[model samples]
Target: MSLPKPVMRGLLAKRLRFHLPIAFGLAITTALVFKYTVTEPRKKAYADFYKQYDAVKEFNAMREAGVFESVRPSGE
Candidate 1:
């Protein structure tokens, strides 16, 4: 048996008010969380690793170019 039109409409309206905000809030919260949690950390880590790698490369170059050879200790 089908619900009467007014009853169906009222039921639908009630359900929408209850569920819609929850769904929309969850979607927005998820998006913000993903951006801050996943994207920001990954970007920071990449930048940090890049900087560290560059520093290491520069250090190696300096060592090879005799800039810090005196500090290298003769035993190695």
Candidate 2:
């Protein structure tokens, strides 16, 4: 026998309620991916450059030379 009309409606409503947010979230995520695809390569290159910069001792020396103050540690 078919489900009662109310039961069928309730099931449909419950399914949509659970799935609508997931559908919207996926759509938004897809749009963001497309939008960022163009920028991602440049961002990756900049990140790689920064990683290399952070690895070099000369970068640390330059950063240290510009430091305006040093905080002395009190007795721990």
The best candidate by TM-score is: 1
In model 2, which range of ten residues has the least summed lDDT?
67-76
TM-score of candidate 2 relative to the true fold: 0.40
The superposed Cα distance between candidate 1 and the true structure at residue 10, in angstroms, equals 3.3
lDDT of 1: 0.83
Q: Estimate each model's TM-score.
A: 0.51, 0.40
Among residues 3 or more apart in sequence or in different chains, the pairs in candidate 2 whose N, CA or C atoms overlap within 3 Å are none
lDDT of 1 by residue, 1-76 (tens): 9976666647888999999999999999999999999999999999988875877668777776678846563346
> Candidate 2 — number of clashing residue pairs?
0
Which numbered prediction scores highest in lDDT against the true structure?
1
Ten consecutive residues with minimal summed lDDT in candidate 1?
67-76
In Å, residue 4's CA in model 2 sits off its true spot by 12
Candidates' C-alpha lDDT: 0.83, 0.73
